[model samples]
Target: MIAASDADKWKKALLEWDVTSLEEHPSSDGVCVCGQTGLLWMYTITNDANGAELFPIGSSCVNHFGRTDLNRRVDVFHKLALVQATANAGKPVEMTTEFFSRAALKFLFEEGAFTPDSYNYGDGVNDYEFLLKMFGKRDKSTITSRQGYKIRKLVTSKIIPFVLADPRVR
Candidate 1:
């Protein structure tokens, strides 16, 4: 596990520079734990040779990550997974950390889960009330309301059907 101090330092360094030098090979192709294809960008900590470490930064990194097209392909995979999961569950499943972190934003966007206006949610009151209502209706045995909202929005949206109808999720 990366220490908090180290993580913070890395974050600071990343913010200061638009790009970092490749200490070694810049990228590697692999499958994420969620089964999605991922490009792991490697970086080395020059400050501490004693504590030298290698880490896989996510695709969001400007450099060393996969091409934009590959990221989009991976996003499609994530959306398909969500659709399959929802269909198999026979009900809308809540979004878990596993879903968001592993899933692609494009899929969420296509599913109407990510709308510019929807994200606004007005102000504190509307957002809080919506959250409260969702919480009240949540299935205690499953995931939390926060997770449910994300999953449900995506499932209900027409985007999944429009985008993936060829595969026939049902």
Candidate 2:
């Protein structure tokens, strides 16, 4: 379903560009730089040499570069979308261990959303420690309602706003 443009101008425009950031469309109505339509995610690519930025490019076009950094960014974007969706749904957001995998938590951690002193439940234990403990429990039945509430609040208050304002994936 993905194809590159055959025109020389398009080929030239595609080269030497690196993805800077991505924007998610509420619907699949976006068009790619290569003329691909029906894209839900649009990537912005910039040429540092010329300071030229092309926007609304689809993920397939980005994948054409085969860059690991770009791929990782795409993955982060998907995870961000999931978090956003839950936050948008309103109160009582569920932070299931399976839903928030180790990678997703690590991404949040790396994004500076989680720190040693961020979560202090008056028990001398930080949020990072509590989250890691919850994440390790594979048994869904072991996760308490109170723990789920804390995780939900964390996602709603911290992660959602951070991702919405500035993802910093680039």
Q: Identify the candidate with maximal TM-score.
A: 2
Q: What value does the lDDT take at residue 166 in candidate 2? A: 67
lDDT of 1 at 114: 35
Native-to-model Cα distance after best TM-score fit, residue 164 in candidate 2, in Å: 3.1
Query: What are the root-mean-square deviations of the candidates from the true structure over C-alphas?
Result: 12.9, 6.0
Write the residue-wise lDDT of candidate 2 on 28-107 in tens digits. Answer: 89999689999888778777556667788788877877776766666666666666656667644455642465666666
- Model 1 Cα shift for residue 58 (angstroms): 20
Model 1 lDDT tens row, 1-170: 22423445654443322211121122446433224354543322222422443343333443333345435444444445555556556655443333333334433344453334455463333333343344454364665657566546644553344434533221
Whole-model lDDT per candidate: 0.40, 0.65
Off by over 4 Å in 1: 1-72, 101-103, 108-154, 157-170
TM-scores, one per candidate:
0.29, 0.66
